[model samples]
Structures are given as C-alpha cells and as structure tokens.
Target: MKFKKRLWKKVSSIVLVAILAISVTGCGKSVSTSADASNVTVVKVGTGNGMPPFCSLDANGKAVGYDVDVLKEIDNRLADYQFDIQSLDFTTLLVSLDSGALDVVSHQLVKSDVRKTKYLFPDQYYCLSPLSLAVKTDSGIKTLADLKGKSINESPSSYEYSLLTSYNQKTLGNTLKINAVSDLSTADNFKQVANGQVDAALTYQSTYKSVQADLKIDNIKLTDTVLVEDTYIMLAKGQEKLTAAINQALKDMLSDGTLATIAKKNLSEDVFANYTSLIQTTN
Candidate 1:
C-alpha cells in the first residue's frame, strides 16, 4: 500500500508539471500572435485638393502626383506599413496633422521656424523648386525689387508675401503696395499678371508650369528664379522613430536615384538637381 501511495504521488507531480508546461506554451503562442498582428502599421496621410503635380484627384478619384508616388514608393519599401491618403483643405491639412488625425503631409511643404517648433521635419529634402515672378511677357520685371511701389498678387499667408513684406520693411520702407486678391488660385493670379491686372504674380516654377500646361499662359513669362524653396515631408510632433525611419528611406531613395526618377516622371525635371544647385549657390 505504501509503495502504491508513493507511486501515485509521483504520477500526480508529473501530471501537474505537464499541465503547467502546456499552459505556458499556449500563452507564449498567444503573445506571439498578438505581436505579429500589432506589427502592421497603417499611416494616415493628409493632402490638399486641386494642388497639381504634387497631389490631385483624377476623374477616377485616384490620388496622382509626385508626392503621392513618393509615398507609394515608401510604402512599398516598408512592407509593414500601409499609407492611406485623405484630401482636405490646405488649412485643414495643417490642423489635422497637428491634431494627430494625419500622420504625414507633403503638399509642397517648406520648412519654417514656426513649423519646426511644432512638427518633426525629416533631415532629407525630397524636392526643390524656384519661386519666380509670373509677369506679362512684355512687363520686363526680372526681380522682386521691381515690385516696389507696384501692385502684385499677394497672399497674407505665403512665403513670397512674407519675403516681400520683409523687403518692404527693410529697404523699401513699405513703398511696395500689395494687391491682396480674394482668389488665391495660381491660374487666376497668373491671369491677373498676364492681363495687366497685377504687376506680377509670385509663383513657384512648378506651379507656373502646371498652370501653363493646363491653360495657355502664353502672355506670362516667369522671371529669374528668386527663391529656391526646399520641400519636405512633415510629420506631426512626437514621431521621432517614424521620422528617423522615413529619413532613412529618403536617403536610400536618393542614393538609388529613385527620387530623381520619380521627379522626372511627374514634374519632368530633376528636383534634386535644382536643390543641389541651391546648395552650391549658397555655398
């Protein structure tokens, strides 16, 4: 009987150990499955409507442009991530990005000191375009200094407007008169310049090209490049790791000639080359 009791106790111990081991194995499998499911990241991207050569919806309602293509390439490179782009108003895009409703935006987004304080800009600059004055071919206004005491299309919130305003405060002493137009469309602004309405329109080379392509701006001539604006992909605050990852991807794309190819395919120019020219000129 004593022998039988001892044998029964040993059997019980073995059974208990086996059960505990199975439970631990089951828990380990559950945790691993959960981790795998969590690994797939979905990124929400924000952009503005009617912004061509960067982001615009087709008649089929598909996002098409250089910015979109770049994001697609990044998505392809990062297999764990899926990017969903939502088109919103330009103001709303900034608000949404700040509010964490959107993870990223690159609607010709330039780096500014104010934005730098609030957002994370990857070290990689994806594109650059020269800002020029779109004036009537006969106007002969080759520089911003010519705008002194003349009417030019100005948006209260624009890089060109800011630069012009600063120039006024510094040298011109408010001599430049700004014609603030209610309609800020590039086509309309260019039209104003072409029709002798505004002295000149501050416009980006890319925007001027896109507008010219869509409509005949035969009368308008773009002045010498004034501002070589650097464009970047902006992320909302507190996304350091994601920003680093994207910067790495951008670096890879630059090294592999992927970025230049995309720019050529979309904008018909090597945007990186333009940026390089800016750096060289600055140096």
Candidate 2:
C-alpha cells in the first residue's frame, strides 16, 4: 500500500506539470493572435454616387472608378490598411467628415479657402477637367462675348456657378441671366439649354463630354481662359497620422506612374500627365 500511494503522488505531479505547460503555450498563442489582429487598420472613406469618373457604384453594387482605384492603390501600398466606402451626396461630404462620421472624403472635392479652414486636404491626387461653356451645335455662340446677356443654368452653390459668376463679372463685365438648379440628376438645367429654354450651360468639361454626343453640342468653347481646376481628397482637421500616410502613399504612387496608368484607364486620357504641370504651377 505504501508503494501504491507513492506512485499515485508521482502521477499527479506529472499531470499537473503537463497541464501548466499547455496553459502557457495556449496563452502565448492567444497573445500573438491578438497582436496580429491589432495590426489591421480600418479607414472610413466618403464618396458621392452622383459623381462619375471620380466615384460611383457599378451594376454589381460595388464602388468602382478612378477614385476607387486611387484609394485601392493607397491601401495596397499600406498593406495592412482597409477601406470602407460610405456613399453620400456631393454637398454632404464635408459636413459628414466634420461630424466624425467619416475619416476621409475620397470624392472629387476641390480645395478652397473656406474648406481649408475646416478640413485638412492632402496633396491633390487628381486634378479634374476644367469647366467650360457648352452650347448646342446649332447655336451661333462661339466665344465669351457671344454669351453676354444670355441665360445660363448651373447647379447652385457649385464651383460651376462660382466660376460662371466670376467670368460674368470679370470677363463679361456684366452678370448674365442665371438659373440655379439643385442637383445634376434632373439635368433640367441641361435640358433647358438643349430645348432653347436657356441660351447656354455652365458645367464641367467631363459633363459636357459625356452628353456632347447625345446633345449634339458642337460649339462648346472655353471662354476667358479661366480654368477651374479641382483637386480631390479631404481629411478631418487634426487627422495628422492619416493625412501623412495618405500623402506619402500618393507621392509614391505618383512617382511610380501608378496614378497615370489608372487615370488613363478610367478617364481615357493621361490625366496625371496633363494636370501635373497645372498642379505644380498652382503650388
């Protein structure tokens, strides 16, 4: 009996040692997994579905376009960063970012003195096509002078409107008849000009290009040589870390020609090359 009791004691001691070793190994693995999970970073980006060539949803319910590609390239370079795109209207993006509902605005947002006061914009990634005055092919208007005293339609509070008003005051020396619309979807503004309800339309170059074939606009001309160049991407004020990371990533992309390639694929032109000089000049 003494021998049996001694053997039982030895067996219990060995069992306890085995259990302790397993517990230590499990704890180590749990810690390693936790650290790995913590390495993943999530960035919330805002986009406008109304803007095409910059950002929009495709038929598969996936966000895909020039801005999407640019953001993806940034993510790919970061390797551990992930992105979640939130769709909103053009005007709401800045407010959403300010309200902390979004970390970044990835749509085609132009930087202005007013915006600089509220948000931090990184180096401009994409320079949008300049705004121009588009008229139907049948219209005899061919220059800025021709648009004098003409009725024009544009979205209210948009850069287009601001540009038009500036041109009217500075170039035309008079304010033309102005009609403000709410959104681009109605194209009511465009339709107004197309049906002769309005004499001309102030809009983006891309907007004119997309509808030119449909609208049969042949007399589209750039007036006053005043180009409105838009640079996109904005971060909330004080988001230094995110802004730095994005700027660095964009700089690398721009150097490696990734941005030029993506721009060519989406916009059908080497937008980066065409606009790089403009960006440098502005800076």
Candidate 3:
C-alpha cells in the first residue's frame, strides 16, 4: 500500500507539472497575440499627387510612385505601426499636416529652413532631387542670367517660389514675374513654357522625361541644375519614436540597395549618384 501510494503521488506530480507547463505556454501565446494587435498604432502618411515617379495617379487613380513605395516598405518593417497613405495636392499636404490631420508627409520633401522650423525630419536623406529650369528651345533662356526680367511659373507654397522670389529680389530686382500657380500639373507648367506663355519653369528632369513620353513635349529644354534638394521624410513635430523608426528603415533600404532600385525604376537614373552640382541646395 505504501509503495502504491508513493508511486501515485509521483505520477500526480508529473501530471501537474505537464499541465502547468502547457497552460503557461498557451496563455503566454494568447496574451502575446492580443498585445501585438492592441499595441499596433496607425500612422497617417500623406504625399503630393501630380508629381510623377515620386507620387502620381495611375489609370485606376491609385497612388503610385517611389515615395509611395518607400512609405509602404517603411510600414512593412515597423510591425508595431500601420501607415495609411493619402495622395493629395502638393499644397494641401502641408496644410493637412499643420492642421493635425496628417502624421507624416512622404513626398520628396526638401528640408528647407522654413520647413525645418515647422516639421520634424528623419536623420537619413532618402534622395537628392535636383531642380532645373525648363525652357523653350528658342526662348533664349540658356541661363539664369538669360531669365532676367522674365516671367516664371511656380507654386506659392513651394520652395521654388521662395527661391525665385528671393532670386528676383536680389538679382532681377523683382522683375522676374513669378506667377503663383497651384492648380497646374508639372506637365502643364512645362507646356506653358513650351507655348511661350512663360519664359521658364523650375522643374525636374525626371518630370520632363515623363512629360515628354506622355505628352510628346519636345520644345522644352532642361538647363543645368539650379538646386540640389536634400529630400527626406517629413514628420509632424515631436514624433521622436516614429522618426527614429523611419530613419532606421531608410538606413536599411540604403544598405540593401533598394533605394537605388526604386529610383532607377521611376527616375530613369540614380538621382543620388554624385548629385553635387547645382547652383544652390536646400541642405
């Protein structure tokens, strides 16, 4: 009887140990899944529409471009965060962010002085987007000197407008008539210049390539770069955690050569390969 009792007690102890081990593991898994689901935060990301290769509407009106893809990849790496991307007008992006409707602006954002004062930016730059002047072949606008006292088209909310405004003030004596146009697409701006409606328009070569292929625009010629803008992801102020995550993602993308691949697919060239020649920079 004593031997039987001792054996029964040992068996009960073994059974209880197994039960507790299984229970703890099952409970841990359930709790971990629940915590993961509940802790994931949704981040609102915004990008400007009408800018091709960076952000634009597809045939189905879905937002597609390098900026969009980069945001998606960033979202993928951060399991704790979900990104909801919105493609909107260029000017509307900044306005929405200021109103607290957006948590991030994923457009090829230039870290201008004014913007740096208002928005937070990741430490790593994703791309170097250089700006050039688009002019008619016979427009006699070979250089900035040639654009003196001439009119140009730009968006009021853009850094181009500020640059042109300041350039006109300092050099052209405000004679460079800068037409503030927000509704015109980038192609239309080039079209206006091609049609001689404006002497020139500050734009990107990548944009002209899309315009040329899509609209058969041949009269416009791109001059040397005027600005080499250091583009990065823009976040609303005080988002240190999100900013850190984005920076890490950018660094990883760079290390893995994904940034170059994306740029080549959309921009037709690696925009970052020794992009050091420009009249000025938004660094």
Candidate 4:
C-alpha cells in the first residue's frame, strides 16, 4: 500500500509538471502572435485613381505608381508604422486631407505659400516639373502676355490656379480671366482648349507628355514655361514627427540614388536632375 501511494504521488507530480510545461509554451506563442503594435499606428495615405504614373489602381486593386512606390519604400524603412492608401478623386483628396480622413497625400502636390497656411509640407521634394500654358495649336498664344484678358479653366484648389492668379495679380496686374472648375482631367482641360471653350489651360510639362497622345491633342500646344514647382508629399497640419521621419527617408533615397532610379523607371527621365536650373529658367 505504501509503495502504491508513493507511485501515485510521483505520477501526479509528473503529470502536473507536463501540464505546466505545455501551458507555458502555449502562452508564449499566444503572446508573440499578439505582439506589441498589433494595434499599430497606421498612416492613411490618399491618392487619386486613374492618374497614371503618379497613382493608379492595378488589376489586383492595388495602388501602383511612382508616388505609391516612393511611399512603399518609406513605409519599408518605418517599422513602427504601417501605411495604407485610399484612392479618391482629385478634388476629394484635398477635402479628405483637410478633414483628417487622410494623414498624407502624394498626387504630385506642389508646395505654395497659400497651401502652407493650410497644410504641412516636408522639408524635401521628390520631383520637379515645369508649368506651362496649354492652348490650341493655332490659337496664336505664345506667352503670358497672350493670356491677357483671355479665359482659362483650372481647378481652384490646384497650385496651377494660384500660380496663374499670382501672375495675373503681380505680373499682369489681374487682367487675365480665371475660370474656376471644381474638377477637370488633363483630357478635359485639353478638350476645353481644343473646343475653344477656354483660350488656354495651365498644366505640367510631365502631365502633357503623358496624356498628349491619349488625348490626341494634335491641336494643342504648350507655351513658354511659366513657373517650375517642386512636388512633395503633403501632410495634414501638425504632423511634425511624421513629417520629419518622411523627410529623412526622402533624403536617404536621394542620397542612395533611389529617388532618381524611381523617377527614371516611371517618368522615362531623371526629373530631379538640373531641377534648380530648370526652375531658374521659368519666368
């Protein structure tokens, strides 16, 4: 009887030890699976769909473009943060960013003093492009002077509008006619010009090149450059930390030639090269 009792005690001890070991191992895996930051800080980025080479939806319903690529590279370097993209229309993007629905925007946004009052821009720009007036080929419009008292359509929220507005006020003494459109595509702008609804349109050189053939804008021609603006990833107001982190990532990419590589891959040229000289040449 004594021997049986001792044997039973030993068996109970062994079973308890085995059970405790299994419990510990299971607990460890559970803790690891739900590790820190599972409730992570996710950065919401907004971009417009169908804006090719900048931001667009792929067949897999993914955001793929030059802007998206740069954002992904930044996200890869930021382990503490997860970045997600929401595709919206061109006009809706600004509203969403202002309402805090989006944390960042990278649809070829240009920094301007007017914009600086509303949103925060990073310290560096990822790309640059010259602004020019797109008009009908035979419109006989060749310079800013030709736009005097002439009508042009542009998005009110766009920097192009502000640029043109500045030119009207400061350079031309506000004689140019500015038509504010809520939303307009590159094709639509060219169409308006082609149809003689507007005498001219303000657009980026890169934008014209990308959609010129598609729009079949044989009748439209670009005037001499008006201004050159550097494009940046716009952030919501008061995101100083996020802005600094992104700026650092951009600088790293610039130094490592990643920025130029991405530009070449998407734009077919190094848009960053000689940007200073290009901007200087703009009037």
The model with the greatest TM-score is 3
Between prediction 1 and prediction 4, the one with superior lDDT is 4
Candidate 4, residues 172-275: lDDT per residue as tens digits? Answer: 55378989887577788789899999999887666777778677767889887777777889999888889998999999999899988998887777877846
- What TM-score, to 2 decimals, does candidate 1 have? 0.80
User: Global lDDT of each model?
Assistant: 0.77, 0.69, 0.82, 0.80
- Output the number of the lDDT-best candidate: 3
> Residue 115 in candidate 3 has what lDDT?
94
The digit string of per-residue lDDT tens for model 1 on 1-283 reads 9999999999999999999999997776231222363786788988766677788888898878888888888866765566887877676787888778999987877776667788898898877767788888887678877776778877665555666776788984546777665537778777777778778887777777887988887888888787687778999887787788788899999999999999999888887876576631210
Screening candidate 4 with a backbone cut-off below 3 angstroms (N, C-alpha, C), the clashing residue pairs are: 168-174
| lDDT tens per residue, model 3, 33-140 | 334768888899999778887899999999998899888888877877889999998878888999999999978777788999999999888887877788988776
Better of 1 and 2 by lDDT: 1
Give the residue spans of candidate 2 off by over 4 A: 1-35, 143-145, 211-228, 277-283
Candidate 4, lDDT over the whole model: 0.80
Cα error, residue 216 of model 1, in Å, equals 0.9
Clashing pairs in 3: none
Mark the 10 consecutive residues where model 3 has the least summed lDDT.
28-37
What is the clash count for each candidate, in the order shown?
A: 0, 0, 0, 1
Q: Write the per-residue lDDT of candidate 2 for residues 143-253, one digit (tens) a residue.
A: 656777888777766655665676677874556877886765524556666678888766655655555545554444334323546576788887888788888888888
